[model samples]
Target: MTAPQTAEQPVYDPSDPSVMANPFPIYAKLREDDPVHWSPSLKSWIITRYTDVRDLLLSDHLSVNRLATFYQSLPPADAVLLKDIVHYLNLWLAFRDPPDHTRVRRILRHAFTASAIEHMRPNITEITDLLLDRLESGGRNEVDLIREFALQLPAFVIMDLLDVPRDMLDDFKEWSDDMAVFIGGARNSGDKYERAERGCRKMSSYFAQLIKERTENPKPGFLMDLISARDEGDKLSEDELIATCILVLFAGHETTTNLIGNATLLLLRHPDQLAKLKSDPALIDSAIEEVLRFDGPTNALVRVAAEDHDLHGRQIREGERVFVMVNSANRDPRIFKDPDRFDITRQQNRHLTFGQGIHLCLGAKLAREEGRIAVERLFARFQNLALDPSEPPEWLDAMVPRGTRHLPVLLNG
Candidate 1:
């Protein structure tokens, strides 16, 4: 079967409400009928199959640094307006390739090692308990889990990791939310460019100050580590340092927030799985992995073709954008047996939630630890946790990140 070239065929639009709510069915159709699809509207080839997505992620034929091309393609006036945003975004480690990426990854690896993440287990537990304390004391059974719990937990965790004060979380969230609108490809957001530019400027300025303070009076955490991180005398430039801090603050919490939110909601919907997990808390690790594979936070990963090449019969021209649908790939039956089933005990899971290869998520371990701690604590605290029947959970309408906008649930303790 193949996607027919007919006017009646529905085009893949990430911003579409129905698709954002539950894209799996559409993903299944595209995977079976058109594994490599070209979206006329998006002007990007969407890769859905697991093998193709993984290979592309690990392939040297693609480039993660597409901001320059984007800026060049923009109108002069628009480009001028977005120069600051592009400058900082260009400096992000995630957007760099080759030697630069290699150097930075080496220096940064020390901070995110398995032992380092495990050491923070106690701190993670403390943060989780603190947040749960607040949630339980709210004097109401109904609450928006995304805002009250899921969002705040990772924000606090990252904030603590950076030695940022708790009072600054609201400001950080505001700036991160604005930037997410632009970076997440929120199609309907008006003035997204301006908002993102403002956010970029404010966040950059804040990080610059923090970096200056940390330089003069170094703290004992990840931020301090990044400040002194040097690989063969190759240290991060001032701009690179600031950009990395912003990246950590933004990317660190946002995806984990989605992970916790998605996992909790999924469990609530699947009482049998929830019961199983509750009965055997040892499955928390496997359950977290399953959540990552089942309905992970990341929706798509974008890359640009480094050179013209044919992929699965489709000619990918240089500079063209490619949307590697990780969500689609995770559900690919070829890689996962009965991929649609929400089985927490599945052992052969090899989902690309954190991506693959050298560009794999730097904070994957932290995110996993955070998710495990958060979900375990939440379920343990509220035995009768469930979705509020009156209000259905709303998913975020963005192309890059998948998460709940609001998860109203009954914490029937």
Candidate 2:
């Protein structure tokens, strides 16, 4: 493949539509030409090698405290506008380091243990069936799968997990999307930040009230567990509790939605692989892993240098942002043979789609099962699941947590 040719920066820009659609070629070029090159466009060092990406993911000096980076660069006006949202996001486990991260993760780990995930399986299957049943009832040969199924399935399931009322799903979804604009690490206009601040206020208030009510009424579910959960003599602070609630609601569905959407699109694009999986249903788990490696949800994991360091023979100053191109690393030639190829049965498919080390995604298990079950039920319900020729899939103009804006597909009744 030809290398990306641009005068502005040799490295590919994440905003480019072509790059967003298919980044492997650019990633391959970067991996070959400048494995640790600094990019003017991204204003950070781009790490493309799989080993470096993996190592940095587990690096102690490189912190995941991105909110600090975000705060340092915040304009006075945007700071005022985004303070509430930023404040809450600062409390997210993803943005924390060391003892703080340990505290929150330990408390919440109870709610996401193996037994918890196992218990959630039947409900997830039931939800998938119910969604497909609804689609069939709609009587449309062509449907926007992202909107009709992929997006809603996770939202519904997460709400159920949180014991949120069914009627509030729409409101929660709106709030969730607004918060994502800020969380996805995508550069947006001032208006977007305003919307996110509003979302932050509304969501925080909503969850705070919910937590308060649960304290008195004592509901049964994940949120209730979090409300009452304790670790030694320490318990979740009110801010931490509210932040955790928002984190679970937002992170829970958003990543899964992208996973389902990206995986379905990849499968539709590669019918042979889809057919292979159909013939051997047991391959669904491995197929999901390949989907993650091929085009996983998150575009990049942002970190900052904790101290002055030399990486790959280049000097990286302390506090400089490093964009770990996960999408690129998954396709690095050194790690996976035929790295660019989409093979479902690829063995030792150790992908960093869910990240690595201390900050591994809390909802990884739930997200994986949701994707597996969603794919199985989706294809099982329709003999012919092909992309809609009437419209092309519109990819979201997002940087992190990449996914399609809309995916229309044709299916048999």
Candidate 3:
């Protein structure tokens, strides 16, 4: 049963610009008043409390296969137009339930092993330095960190990992941006489906060709590994291979880009903490964790109920959509002391930015390494780094992914 609305209760609307800007206040309100409230605006049950969101993510009753539910909810015409989008999304490991999820995850685990990520550390640093070198050579004191450094570092690192040519960077960004609108659940983007479909077509076609070429002449890289990865004599089908490549290409850089950007902005906003990090460079890891808890790239994760479940006197029926509000839970007063404060040295931090349980982000280690190295080198390179006074940071008007659209900063501050 849905909770009754009260005048004091703030409505949960992601489309609202204010909400998009800073949803924590409304998230706090929802967490206090109705933790498991059904929102008519989004037509999905919004789970706010830390425990509720955590348990649901770790629960078997909730499935990550929500794309089909979304397709069904759309008008027939729109659904038909997004058929290819659904097809590719369905093949993604993120959208599958075990034993499909279990098998693919096993294969991927071998590829993203700690040693593999650690081996890339040097390359990550090289890419970071290369980007900073370019920035320094540009002779521009003012730069959009999001565009110039943060976004490029991860994209290049992932490209190098996959052995993708450097020339495809711009195309990948364009395609990734288009798909983000749909995948990230941009509430206000009316043409999201069309844009995403176009991205999907181009991306899938490109990967299909790449996979064929790689299969013909084997290479020693991540893409080649995906091409030949197997689990207990089982391997990914052709379609699955293409889908996994796209997932790796997209998810590989998007969140980490946001992490770098968000971490930079947060540190700039809290100079005390920024100075603390500068003094103790080892605090980079803890600082990254703090940034995720404070304002992580992923705001929420969508899941669909596989069976009826009751929580806090609210019934979530089967097939109904549920959004586990990660940003809200990270700030739950019950969970963290002074949750709002940006503290790098904080201990026992367990933010759900990478999610939990079976669906925990596969590239977590890679992202952490990328963010730590990127931020560490960035600050090390520009000791006087500061936000540009003329242009302020702008947050992406997105619901699922929390990131700044532009983080203008004075490089030589």
**Winner by TM-score:** 3
Q: Count the backbone clashes (under 3 Å) in each candidate.
A: 0, 0, 0
Positional deviation of 309 in candidate 3, in angstroms? 1.5
Candidate 2 C-alpha error for residue 201, in Å: 0.8
What TM-score does candidate 1 reach? 0.97
**lDDT (C-alpha, whole model) for all candidates:** 0.89, 0.86, 0.89
lDDT tens per residue, model 1, 254-278: 9999999999988988989998998
Per-residue C-alpha lDDT of model 2 across residues 1-413, encoded as one tens digit per residue: 11243564356677788887777788888888778778767678788889999999998869888677777688899888888988898899988998999988888777678888898999999999998999989978989999989999999898888878767978998888787777775554446887799899999998898888888899777777888787786788999999988898898898899999999999999999999999999999999999899999888888888888887667787788888989889988788999888999999998888899998998899999999999998998887888998899887766778789799899862
lDDT of 2: 0.86
Winner on lDDT (2 vs 3): 3
Model 2: worst 10 consecutive residues (lDDT sum): 1-10
Q: Model 1, stretches more than 4 Å misplaced?
A: 1-10
Candidate structures ordered by TM-score, highest first: 3, 1, 2
Model 3: residue 183 alpha-carbon error in angstroms = 0.7
